[model samples]
Target: MILSLLGRLGRLWIVPVALAVWELAAREARAVYFPPPSGIALHVYELWFSGPPARLFLTDDAVAHILPSLGRLLLGWSAACLLGVVAGVALGRSARLSQYLSPLIHFARSLPPPVLLPVFLVLVGVGTPLQLAGIVFGVVWPVLINSIDGARYIDRQYLDTAQVFGLSRRERLTRVILPAAAPKIFAGLRLSVALALIMMIISELLGSTEGVGYRLLIAQSQLDILTMWAATLLLGVLGILFNAAFLAVERRVLGWHRAAL
Candidate 1:
């Protein structure tokens, strides 16, 4: 039991050790741009998380900015994934459709989504719609390509077996194709989460008010170095949490797949 506990603690020791090193280096350097993690943490707390206990200690700014940003991120990623999966599945199942559309997909994906921010702005105007479109455009390609690949490369044996069983089209898809393609689909989804966060920030960078990205832009404009670093730290932590959550879900959903392998 002690050994197991030690093993768990051992894995996490590097985090504290790294922070200690950073703290010492930043103190020694006395750089305005590079504040210690402790200070950054406190600053972020004071800025966003210092509300009444009833509200889970989240300040107004936290509610105003963080929530909207999170909402946008979730909505955008979800929309993109849903669209990608549906379209990808249809295209994968249809050779002619894929043949006609593959070139267009590649060309559209080749154009940087950030560059098209202006186009989106012109089309959709500013605010949530614009941000959502940007994120969808940027992150959808991975999911689409992976979904298509997953659907296209499914084993013939599985299809034959399904046909023998007389499974309906929906049943074949839900039971066979999706299960087989889940790993690739999940890979794309995981990658898109990171891209979603990036695009979330990028979308907010050039546009209107509110969001974590806007906070960063504000800090930079005001030369609030500490706030900037704190915001950065918060973003890093959020990224870690997002990735961790995705991994947990993937492990749970694909546990059988892993065991089979």
Candidate 2:
């Protein structure tokens, strides 16, 4: 127990040590653009415990900004996951359909979503839909491609066995194919989550009334370095939280695969 506790403590110490080094470096360089760790921490505390009026969290405004970004991320990512998995599964199950759609899928995936933000803005206007579209467009390809690859890689012997049992297509897919392809689907989801978060921030940065990115922009305009650092720290925390939550869900869902890993 003592050794385990010490090990954990040692691991946790790395972050502070790195931050200290960064703080010293920033101080030495006298770089106004790069705030030291202590300065950023002070900003983080202020944002978390007290903020000026008109921000989301009057007491803890960080939560307000964080929640909106998270909401956008979840909405867009959830839609992508649903559509990507369904389409990928169908395409994987049907070689003819896959061939027919391959060119179009490739073309769409090849295009950068950032470049199309203006087009989306024109079509959908600067609203939730446009933001969601950007997030979905940025993230959907990974899920779709990974799902298709997962489905296609299922063993031929398993298919033969299912055929011999006279299982219906739906039964075969639900009982066998989906279970086998779950890992790949999860991988896609993990990748998409990160991408979705990035897109959410990008969308907000482009034109948003509220959100961490918008707050960061505001801080920049006002030359409020502390607030800017606070926003950045909030973003970093959000990213860590998002990743941790996804990892927890993945572990819960794929517990059986742990042994394989």
Candidate 3:
């Protein structure tokens, strides 16, 4: 147990070491734009965690900036996953439909998402709707393409066995096809989550009034380097927490697959 704990701490040693180095360097340099890590940490706490413990320990600033971004992230990711998986499965199952849509899908995926931001702004206006559009557009392709590939390439024997067992279409899909495709689906989900977070921040950076990205932009505009770093640190922490939670869910859902492997 002690060795396991030490191993974990050893693995994470770089983080603290890097922070300590930065702190020392910044103190020695005394540059106005490059505040020490301690300053950044203090600012982050004051800006986000100064509230009472009962309210999730979130300050008003945290509520305003963090909550909205998180909400948008969830909404966009859920929508993208639902639409992507459904469309991907349909396309994969229908060769004719896949062939028909191939050109359009390739074309759409080729375009970078930032290019669509202006179009979204014009069509959806500047706010949550626009942000959701950007996030969905940017992140959907990975899940859709991964799901398509997974479903299309299933073992022929599985289908033969399902047919021999007289399984209905729904039963075959739920039990055989989806189960086989679970690993690929989880891979796409992980990629989509990261992309969703990135797109959410990008969407907030432009034509938005409230969000973590917006606050970071404000700090930059006001030349508050310490606050900017604090906001950035907060973003990094949020990403880490999100990924950890996502991994936990993935482990639970894919436990059978892991055991099989």
Predicted structure with the largest lDDT when compared to the true one:
1
Arrange candidates, best TM-score first.
1, 3, 2
Candidate 3, residues 1-261: lDDT per residue as tens digits?
Answer: 999999999999899999999999999999998899999999998889989899989999999988999999999999999889989888888889999998898888788878898899999888999899999999888888888888899999999999999999999999999988888888989988888888988899986889999999999999989889998888888889889999999999999989988
Whose lDDT is higher: candidate 2's or candidate 3's?
3
Each model's TM-score, in the order given?
0.96, 0.88, 0.95
- Steric collisions counted per model: 0, 1, 0
- TM-score of predicted structure 2: 0.88
> Over 4 Å off in model 3, which ranges?
none
Model 1 lDDT tens row, 1-261: 999999999999988999999999999999878888889989999999999999999999899888999999999999999999989888888888999999999998788778888998899887889889999999999999889998899889999999999999999999999999898899889989999998988899878588888898999999999888877888888899999999999999999989999
State the C-alpha lDDT per candidate. Answer: 0.91, 0.85, 0.90
Candidate 2 — what's its lDDT?
A: 0.85
**Tens digits of lDDT, candidate 2, 138-242:** 999989988888888898898899999999989999978998899999999898888888888888888777778888889999999888888878788878998
> RMSD of each candidate?
1.3, 3.1, 1.3
